[model samples]
Target: MRMRLLVVGLLVAFMALTGCAKNQMSTEPGTQAGENAAVATDSQNSNGLSEQDLADQQRQAMAAAEQEITQNRIYFGFDKFDLDAEAKDVLKTKAEALKAHSEWKMLIEGHCDNRGTEEYNLALGERRARAAYEFLVMLGVPSSNLKIVSFGEERPAVDADNEAAWAKNRRDEFKLFK
Candidate 1:
């Protein structure tokens, strides 16, 4: 009886291993059936993305945007649109990059940390985006190649209730236009 049971278990394990190996080989290109199988398997599995996978996806996305026009949003301290020395330095570099590529268009998205009333935050965000736009114009970026939008406090980079997150949430984002 023991020998019979051991034999059965070994057969079951072998079958499982064989199935996995077949699936692995199916993912290789040049095999239409395998490709279809792999796609079916991936579709069936809705697991969350891994960190490394997420990073790889982000890299691919940036590469795809390489030829498109890009925009950068300049962040600011609460209640102020004045560019500090560091912010000014960042803007200068951005200006040079944009001027070098005249065909690229950009949209500056202004955002604020979640600390103020919605209406107030929206105004602040608009001010921040406008400040960057003006600086870019002064730096020789064409007005026709730039646009602006303010998201206010509704969109926070970090949702945690902490100063560190707030600081990160208050930022300007750059979107690329194809």
Candidate 2:
């Protein structure tokens, strides 16, 4: 009986506090129901995030993940599709990001230098993209979240006829879905 009364008293106190806050929340000129709900939740949730707060955090997280995945292009050797140590490290980071954010979907775009025939370059590009895709899958990213496309030598990061340009071109790139 004593415990029951204590519980009831606590409930009353909570209701009083919530009521006061919720009322103050509605005093604004154009307060909506959702905004009020968010305000109420802010006072209760441990995360201390209202609806907008959570949304903003999620957007920021995705942007960070997108930057991690896209900024470091995975370059391959001449006529090679195998991953080097640097590429593997980058993919490991990417896999961690993808694992943390399963809601994110991405496209792995394969590219090549303008040395091989169009057909060969296309196939090589596909192979390069597949290599990255397989590595990510091995590191525990869901295959369903990833898709691959081969641009072959059509999209060059540095459009010049030099070893440096070719090295940049012989790479795999990443794109995050909107």
Candidate 3:
């Protein structure tokens, strides 16, 4: 009778550890979540996942979101509305990314050097901003996802009256919206 009891206990232990039963199909004979993947779909076959699968999918999604956020910065040139070849290259890359992430939105901030009148600079800045906006729209970024604002000569990047300062001040900056 003692031998029979021991044998029964061993069998129960084996079944529990191996995740094996006549009604279930467990390829790995273990319940280490991902380990016995075969039995996973069975529990959720009608509805889905054992919690672990859902978490993994969420993790992958978050990783992709982070990667997209990392790649989304844009730069511009000095007092220029038209995209130079270099700026176009960069914009192409940005446009492709933005197109891929259709849900993303952007704000384009147009700036100018302090040499001009505030009113004149504001108009110039608007022109510059619109140039970028138009180009981005042409490249497949939806018009609705883009907003343009002109800072005029109000925000001087260098805060100095020099060629270097003017060059740095006149630029279009890109900001992403979550």
Best by lDDT: 2
In candidate 1, what are the lDDT values of residues 10-122, reduced to their tens digit?
Answer: 99999887776545554567698778886776666466566567788877755545433243334577667678877777777666667766777777888888888899999
Q: Evaluate all candidate structures by whole-model CA lDDT and list the values in order.
A: 0.75, 0.91, 0.76
Error of 1 at 91 (Å): 1.3
* Candidate 2 residue-wise lDDT, 108-151, digit = tens: 99999999899999999999999999999999999999999999
**Candidate 1 off by > 4 Å:** 1-73
Off by over 4 Å in 2: 1-55
Cα misplacement distance, residue 159 of candidate 1 (Å): 1.2
Model 2, global lDDT = 0.91
Which window of 10 residues has the lowest lDDT sum in candidate 1? 64-73
Clashing residue pairs for model 3: 18-29
lDDT of 3 by residue, 69-152 (tens): 344433446545777776677677667767877888877788898876899889888888888889989998999999999999
lDDT of 3 at 30: 63
